[model samples]
Every structure is written in structure tokens, then in C-alpha cells.
Target: MNNFKTESFDLNRAFLLDSSHPPSSIVTKLHPLNKIMAEGQIHEDIPLLVMELDNQAIAFITPQLAYQHIVQGVLNGQAWLVSFCSICNGGAVFSPLVDDEVYSFQEGGFYDAMVLLYDVQSGSYWDHLTGNCLYGSLVGKELKRLSNLLHMSLRQVLAAYPDALLALSALPEQQQTEAEEDEAWRKASEPEWSKGLVKTLGVEDNRLPRLNMGLGVWTETTRRYYPVAQLYAMNNVLIDMVDGQRLITYIDPLSGTPGAFFTDASQAEWQHNILQLNNGDSMRDMVIFDANMMLKRPQRPFQLFVRWYSFALKFPNCEIYGQPVNTQG
Candidate 1:
């Protein structure tokens, strides 16, 4: 409601030349197969096209449409703060309560997400070539498209979490037979609990790590001085924080309410949150702690998807090692 924007992805049908392909309904719904078919129409492979990049996927939807999504989805009700910590970079504590000029958290919203602009381009900490805006709308598309991408993006999965473990939730009780267990969920989610992780990771079957995210990404960095991600079979998708890596965690529940973006917050505050999430100097410190709730509502998950991807970009040489944990029947 703060401003308006738009883009479109209409599902169009295609008749395949191969009769061996499964029935149309099931074929179109299949992950790898469907993604391959959809790519020719979408103009690019959504998986590699979106996933190969770093920092918020940089969706190139129209600028106005992108900003509208930002305002409505997350900029509406959020609050923001900047760090003056000497660790990351000693600078301003600029808060909405303090200065209203250069750092306004009151009502004077930013003209653009960047500090400087030309005919229309803006300066950025990332994406120098594209001039992509950092607001959540333009960047945070991964979370929204996770389920779709997991199937379409790549045919193979590489489960490379630091602990070398996988937690597939939404499974069956031991009392049930193996065949019955797999059939019960029927691809609703990853196996509720998989046996291979315990055997392979050397973790006790009865033991699992408790959730302790006080350090945010710092603890994750301890294992490797960079971001880490491990792929699991769709049936092995997890709902809880898994081991030292909480792969599927969502934002604080309060931050996920509908219309959280700019709804109760002032325009200036909304814009401030956008900057902090995108490339504000203080954002670097955020990786050390939870920092403030940056996005308004649903985007917190999507935003993390981008940030994690960005972190990986920072480590181009990130060693990709680890034996693949098989999830097939």
C-alpha cells in the first residue's frame, strides 16, 4: 500500500514430443523434469539463473513493482538499528531516535536504496554492474521459491553441512514397517527422521543438538570462516534446527505476521530496515548476532536465503567436500 509495483509469471502449457514422459499432470508437477520444461518459457533456468548468484538473488522485476513488494511484505512494521562496534567498522550508532537528517527513522523515507544515483542507477555494496536495488523485494526470492527450486534447480543434491548430518522430518514411527513409513508421508516433506544421519555422522541415535543461535552466523563461521549450506533429499527436508547448522529456521515468530512490512511503522523506518538488510555498513556486524528484526513479515526467511547465498559468494573458494548421504529408497 505504501507504493505499487508488479511483475508476472503465468503458467503456460506445452505438449511434449516424448510420449514416455509421465501423464501431463504428474509430469508438470515433477521437480527436475518440470523445471527443465519451465525454463524455455521463463526465458532462463530459474535454478542456476537465480541460485548461481550471491546476495539476495537480485530479482530484476520492474523497480516500482519490486519496491511495492518491499513496502507491503516487510518495510511496513519493522524497526532498525546501526552498529558503532569497532569490530566490524567503527562508525555511527545512527538510530531513528537520534538523528533525523542523514539517518531518518521518522517519516522521510529514502528516495532510493542506494546513497548516490545517476539518471536512475544507485551505488551499492553489491551488484555494481546491475545497479540492483537492495530492498527485500528485489533480492529475497529464494525462500519463496525454495520448494520449487529444490526440485528444479539441480538433479543431484550435495548434503555438505559441517556436521555431515541430515534431518528429514514428517516421517513415521518405528512401530510402522519401512514400506508403510515411506508411503505415509508420500513426499509431503523429507523423511520425518532418517536413520542414515546417525550412522554416518557418528552422532548417537538418541542424541540431537539443542537450538542455540545466540551467536547467529558466527558459530556457523567457526566451522569454516564462510557461509555453508548442505542439500538434502526433498524427503529429508528438516523443520528443526539441525546440528550446528540451523538450515531451515524461520525468523522470530513476531516478525512473520502478515503485513509486517510498513503497516505500523513510519515510511522512514521502513526504508531504514531495507538499507540495513541490503548493504548498510552496519549489516556486517549483524552476522555476529541476531541484530534487529530487519524484514516486516514473511520475508525474514527469504531474506536469510539471500544473505546466506551472499555469504557463499564472499567465499568463492569455499571447499565443497563431504560424502553424499543417500536418501533414496
Candidate 2:
């Protein structure tokens, strides 16, 4: 409901790369797949957070860049905070504009196994998943949600937008090197629960493993959890009725991230590794096409990737798909 006025804010100021700099200096014009093959910095299976702005694309290595950007406050109107926790596999993008003012954020700490961000303007800690102020004057207030963040692999991103200019940081080489090292360490570390390394008090959800990854969809009257393992076992596509609306869920084979969409009409099937439709057309990943091969925006649903245990704790009554139906004689 809040109309953001981004006209006054310069996109260049928010991102490290801008038009003033020579394209060859700051921009890396390469296909994501090629980049991954060349650098070997990250695996092809890991998902990346990419944003397309004004015909350019900025890709962030989720595990590394998420923490770096939040700690460095290297974001503006053009860049929002995209945070993902490897421990829980929870990812979200937070709008910088809060309460009519733009606030810079840094890593605050943790609460209930979730990251807490501290805003520079109000000095308040906010829950990373919910964006609600926890321990500041702004307590009880919530940060506005921005556009739906896309989680996909570099290859999938380049496939969707071939002309997207991959933006890299213009920072000094030493700082960048340190960030990369930190990210590498983070990626290798396993969750405490998974290794039985740490014991903490938390709600127990027996439906699935506490550390298992799942995609969560939250609405006013409904909360649903689609376990990624179940989705994969179901051939990576699951269609079900949610709150009187037919919802289609799938895991992108390229990125391994889960996504959901609401269809005006219930019509979806899989054929030849593509999601086929009754209209004589098909969909590959997030892009949708008609029978004549025209592009269209079918529907957008609120969804995020989170751990099953985290979701269970947040929404105790949430429904889990693929659960066995209790039958009594």
C-alpha cells in the first residue's frame, strides 16, 4: 500500500557500480554458468540472489554476500538486503525504506535461531525473517516488504535475461578477498542440529527433521509448508488446493530453490523436463508462455524458503504437504 518514491534516490549511490565508471572496469559481462565454471568459487547447485535493474543484473553469492552487504551497509534504493541462512536455508529480501525513511542495516545478532538486523537510523534490532523491530524505540513496527526476490542459479538468470549486466563490487582487492574467505568458511560449516553439535531449547516438530529445508507460504488465514525433500520426491512439482485457490509449486532444477504460483485456471503438467500446460504451451522455470509462445505474468504468490523447524516454530498450526491422512475405523 505504500508507494515508494525512488525517483529522488540515485541508483548508482546504492550499488557499488554506476554509469560513471567504465563498463569494462566494474561490470562483468559473462554468462552465469561460465562464471561458475571459471571461478569455481561456488557450486552450480547453490542458488544465487540476482536482481535486474535498468537492464543490468547484480548477482550475489547468497552465503557470502548476504552477510557482507548487511554488515557493510552497501545497499541503497537499487539494492535491497537479501539474507539467507545456510543453517536453516531461510532467505528473504528486506526493503531499505522503513517508516518513510531509508535505514541502513547491520548484523545485530540472533533470536529464536533467526538473524536480527540493527538499523543505523533508529538503532533498533529487527527480526530478519519478519522484519519486525524487536528491541528498539521502533519496537512493534514492521519493515515494508519489497518486490518478490528471485532465487535461482546464475545459469537460470542468464537464460531469463541474457542482456543482464553482472555487477561486481568496486571495493579494494583486500576487503573483497576477506569477504570471499569468510563466505567459503561459512559454506563448509554444517548446522549444529545436523551434527548434534549444539543443544538448545526450541519447539519440536516431528512431522519432519528440524533442520530439513522447506518452502513456506504465509497468508492472513493460511500458513503452508512444502518440504523440499517431499517436492523432490514428487518429481519436483506439486499442485494442490490452498484456501480455495489452486496453487502450483515446483523446485527449479537449475537453482534448487522452491517457488509457487497461483493459477487462474487449474492446468499444469510436466513433460520433457518442462511444465506443460493445457493451452498447448509450456513453462521453463519462472517464465510462462502461451500457446503461441508469448511471454506473460500469470500470477505472483508470497513465498519464501525456510527450514521446516523454523516454520513450525513460527506458525505452529502450519500445514505440511505429503503428510499421511489419519484413518480410523
Root-mean-square deviation of every model: 23.0, 9.3
Residue-level lDDT of model 1, residues 91-113, one tens digit each, is 11111221222111111112211
Give the C-alpha lDDT of model 2.
0.59
- Total clashes for model 1: 19
Show model 2 residue runs off by greater than 4 Å: 1-46, 51-58, 66-79, 163-167, 170-190, 193-201, 265-267, 324-329
Root-mean-square deviation of Cα positions for candidate 2 versus the true structure, in angstroms: 9.3
Model 2 pairs in collision: none
lDDT of each: 0.19, 0.59
Q: Candidate 1, overall lDDT?
A: 0.19
TM-score of each: 0.20, 0.72
Model 1, position 78, has a per-residue lDDT of 25
Q: Write the per-residue lDDT of candidate 2 for residues 172-261, one digit (tens) a residue.
A: 778667756555644442443422222222445667776677788866666788988889888888788877887888887656678887
Error of 1 at 47 (Å): 18
The TM-score of candidate 2 is: 0.72
Best by TM-score: 2
